[model samples]
Target: MTSPLSGIRVLEIGDRIATAYCGKLLRDAGADVVMVEPPAGHRLRRYRPAGVPPSAGDSPFFSFLSGGKRSISSPTVPPELVDSADIVILGSTPAEAADLGLDVDEIACRTSVITVSNFGWSGPWIDVPATEFTLQAWCGSTGSRGEPERPPIAVGGDLGEFIAGSYAAFFALAAHRGGGPFDMSVLEAMTTSMQVFSWLRKELMLLEVLGRSTEVPSVERAKDGYVGISMATGQQWQDFCAMVECPDLADVPELRFQVGRWEQRDLIRARTADFFATHTVAEIVELAALFRIPMTAIGNGETLSSMDHFIERESFLSHPSGFRAPRAPWRMSATPPLPPALPPALGDTDSPWTPRESRAERTGLPLDGVRIVDLTAFWAGPTATHLLGMLGADVVKIESVQRPDGMRFAGGFREDVERWWEYSWVFHGVNSGKRSITLDLGSEEGRALFGRMVAEADVVVENFTPRVMENFGLSYDELRGFNEQIIEVRMPGFGLDGPWRDRVGFAMTMEQLAGLAWLTGYPDGLPTAPRGACDPLAGVHAAFLTLAALEHRRRTGQGQLVELPMIDVVLNASALQVIERDVAGVLLTRRGNRGHEFAVQNVYACAGDDQWIAVSVRDNDDWHALKAVLRQPVWAHDLIYAEDTADLIDGHLADWCKDQPRDETVSAFLAAGIPAAPVVQPPDVIDNAALQARGFFQTLDHPLCGPLPYPRPPVTGHFVNSAAPLLGQDNAQILGSSLGLTAQDLARLEDDKVIGSWPLGL
Candidate 1:
């Protein structure tokens, strides 16, 4: 079957995960992607897995990201080929691109160009070196992870780079139908991907103002292992207590509401902790599912690999290292992805496509003329609709006046403001570019109005539990009856048919359940929540699948239901651990901030309070370069140190770095061609020069917030209406324009409480 991107040509420059994975996505969609590496080949190719034959030339990390793409060693490719390409993905800094003689403007004029970087081309820290750890730190994710007493720990693997790559692929595909010179900052991508924390932080500020406590237990240990539990609603809390056979606690008035539970969290935690200690993870999971409680085992690599669902779904591809690699996060009936293939050898000139006639001129954004009815709240589902909105879809977000999106009230900023909803940067950030209309789906009139809107919408999206749509009479079958061509995308924590389908889950709990928490943190320490990365990961998958469904409908003239189980998407993101467990029959364990693949990798203290730098030495050349940068100290030249004795080398490296400024240490190591970066915090990320130069942050003058810096979506060359609609801001416009409802009708609906511009109590 011909893939969606069959005729497209993608040129990937740089060996970084972001660019490589972006190319992989394009390749999966049947694009002819050619990766260009330096003369020595890409640095990632040298990342050899233990016991792998050298002739294989396959590094699990590199192969997983760069698979199904051709390669060329030369820095400079022919300009004719560049001109003929449909997209160019550059993973280098602005300086590196200029040095390579790759004119960004000239290339963008001919085809789309997406430049991915650490901070961005024009940010103040654009020249400052960075790594996954530092990016997470600067983005606020690391700071929120683990126990507050312990120093922040980075999440396992290059999740920041992985997320940036997903954004790059989405933007590239969007630009292909339009045109571009887009720029993406890994830091910004990571920040936005996990923006749910921003909301939580804001909630804390409001709680403080209201004299309320803000404390909750994210992870707790069971008899054999750990499990994550979330009781967002009072009913879930009651169910959890009942499942544990704690009828007395379930009846306690303080444990009835989420706020009351927070106020008396210490007492509640002590009781639950003891109860959890008496049960095993499997037993807890079973009871939670049976009782419709929001609790799940903190699975490890072994548990994930042994799962029947993933194995049956064929979520992984075989790896040469006896492990496995993740397949694309989506599948389709028609226009399915191309089969996976190993990354091509450097300088291999194999081309998958022959010259074709120039395509006809493309006009508006890729999703132009499409309309979506968005019934999602928080990050994941909203993020999907936001991306679609940026791609020129007319998205109408429906919220009830009685139950507004929590983000509207959870502004992370402390402002002397009157109307709180208008000042919510968290809500505005993700909801921008979409219209808003209030509809109480519980009401008969509201349901009738929603059906009318769905009839005109091409897509309907919701992230509620399995029973929500059915309860509201807005399920896929009902929507299909209203409009046969309407595509319905449902994002539930578990799938619709599973025993756990009714269980409640947030991003934090889902991460633990999917084994991400167990894979992070110190070796002997407890599991840590990796913030909200799972939400954006799921969001990206939902958006990609939605587009695929749209394409299928375009060809077949039929629409279908798209189910995106949040747990499945999160597990797929951590495919490495599953693969390792599958191959080695052992669960992967956390190693703190240490690198598993590199010989010498650790975070070391540097000059200044709380300042640090991360360094990774992969081989002899890297060791030599690092030693030279450190002034060739006697200890650095030791054979034991050179032989990958990471624990022993870490102490010596820490001593060496203690007196050196973080920037200096990072610069020296980078200049010497060693992988090193400073641990930048959130304050350092703001007011960054590169981000400023690239206009990564835009100032939107909100009515209540005045003006605030909003991070632009990591894509360019498309219509981005930056204004986020106020509550029911588009009620009149939408009612009159689409549904032909008169102002009197809207007033009547408002009087009947079927529509409103603000929350009922507020």
Candidate 2:
């Protein structure tokens, strides 16, 4: 099948995995991408897996990323290729990009330039070097990781770069469709992908939206392995209690609410934890499925290859070298995605394409003038539309009065207030800048009215299980009937056609099933994750495919269906872990605060209460510099020159850090040229000095929630001044005024239970 980007030509001159992955996505979509590698080749080519053969030329990880792309070993980009290229991706600082002859101003107006860097284009630290850990630390989302008392740890497997690469692909296609060149900060991308904007801004502390835990017994031990469970609503909680056969908790009114359950967690855990410990993983999995609960066993890299779902879904592709690699994270109808293939060797396919005229840039935000019908409820679906809305798309969020977006009551429930749902900062943060209108699909009038809205919309996005849309008679076929060029994007937990498609899975399920959770946490402990990463991972990926579909429609006047499975995205993000089992003949587990690239990486306690700092001695230079700063004794230095001094140095470093303030210590590390950052608390994340100076958070005013700081779009410059709409706030404005419905017609419909601003019974 021909891809949406089959005819496009792309030139990739990037350094980070983010850029390579972006180009790889373009290539996977059938674009002709020519990778310009340094004479020594990309760093990934030499990135050997732990305990694996150290043959630099046969890197399985590099092949996983660069697969199916043509590679040329060249000192510089071919001039003719620049003009012929539809896009040029550069993963470097502005100065370095200029040195590589990829200066934005110097490039032709037609060739879209995409730049992804550790900091960003104009930031003070843009030119400074940064490791993956440094970027993860700066993003603020890592604040919620690890035990609350322990120093925060970076999520393993370079998740920040994985997210950045996903967002870069989204922006790349946006730029191709006259959205203009973009400079994306990997830090912002990581934060955004983790839904820090929705969580940190509202002070939910972290991503508790969708189905991961904030105030629940989320991670628990099974007889053989660990499992993650999430119950976002009261029904789910009661169901959980029933499944555990906890008579005291089952059908209990107080336990129905999260806050009440949290307050009585000791009692709940006593009953639940015992049940978990006594059951095997298989027994628990079966029980959870029988109860239709959103739970799954936590599988690590080694276990993932053995999953029944993995085999049934054909999640891996066997390479020519007899190793396996993950397939694409998403799929689409009309134009299916290409399978993973071995990457080209150096100097292979060095041939250049003929010169072509560049397309002109469009004005305003990337998605300007596009209208989206958003039917998403929780984090993943709302997040995708949230990003599109930020890009200037007119997003109309469709919810029903009987059952609005579950996120409205996600964080809390104030029984005293009549309009308590309107005050949810979590809902406001995720749904910002989108219009809301109520319509009961169960009613004929509501369905008819929705069909009209669909006719005027360019895209319809939903996170419902595959059957919900078809049950509503508003599937892709129905949407296409309303508007032949309407892009239908589905965010399913498993996928549209997988054997587990109908199973109730959430981000927690994905994190465990995809092997990411297995790679997190301390080496000796059970797997945990950077809470609900699969939400935004799938969110941004959905947006990327939606953009691709839009571009395809622009060219061929046809809109198709795109399926973004939350688990697949989690699996793909854990690709770095996936390759290890294939190459090293062993699975890599969590290493706590330890790092792979650096000589010494760990966290140390500071003087203040629960305060800490993370420092990495990249090499001997940083180690020597740290010792000089600490004024270590001559005897200590005489003990060793370069033979396993990391642990010894770390012990001494811990003593020195205990007496110093965290921020002060961080400054000292930075001054001494060491990679370091504070493990920021949730409140401190909002007040991060660097983020404040960069204007990362801009204030947006909501009627009920008042003025609040909203994080800017990951790639866009800043946020629009609009706010998340009150439930059904746009009904009168849209139905009566815009959709040509008479006032009398609206009133009659409201009286007939066809529409409402609040839940009918409430």
lDDT of 1 by residue, 680-722 (tens): 5443444454556667666666555455566667653334566
Q: Model 1 Cα displacement at 508 (Å)? A: 2.2
Candidate 2, residue 246: CA error in Å? 2.0
lDDT at residue 720 of model 1 (Cα atoms) = 54
The local distance difference test score of each candidate is 0.72, 0.76
Positional deviation of 339 in candidate 1, in angstroms? 4.7
Q: For model 2, how does the per-residue alpha-carbon lDDT over 1-762 read when each residue is reduced to its tens digit?
A: 679888888888876878988888888888888888888788788776333556636477778888888887877777777888888877888777676666576774758887788777765676555667766666555555665545666676677778888888888887787765787788777766664454443443223322113446677888777878877676788778788888668666777766567657778878888799889878887888888888887876677766777788887778665577677877888777777787888878656687786476477777888999999987889889988888889999999988999877765666656788786655766788899999999777888888998899889999998888889888888888888888889998988876677888877678777777777777776677567777877888888888888878888888888888888788877876667777777777777776555556777888987676777777677777787778876646764533266677778778889999988888878888887877664445566555666777778776766677777766637755687788889999999899999989889888877888887666
Extract clashing residue pairs from model 1: 122-689, 122-690, 123-689, 123-690, 123-691, 124-689, 124-690, 202-412
Error in Å for residue 38 of model 2? 1.9
Task: Judge candidate 1 at residue 404 and give its lDDT.
Answer: 82
TM-score for candidate 2: 0.93
Best by TM-score: 2
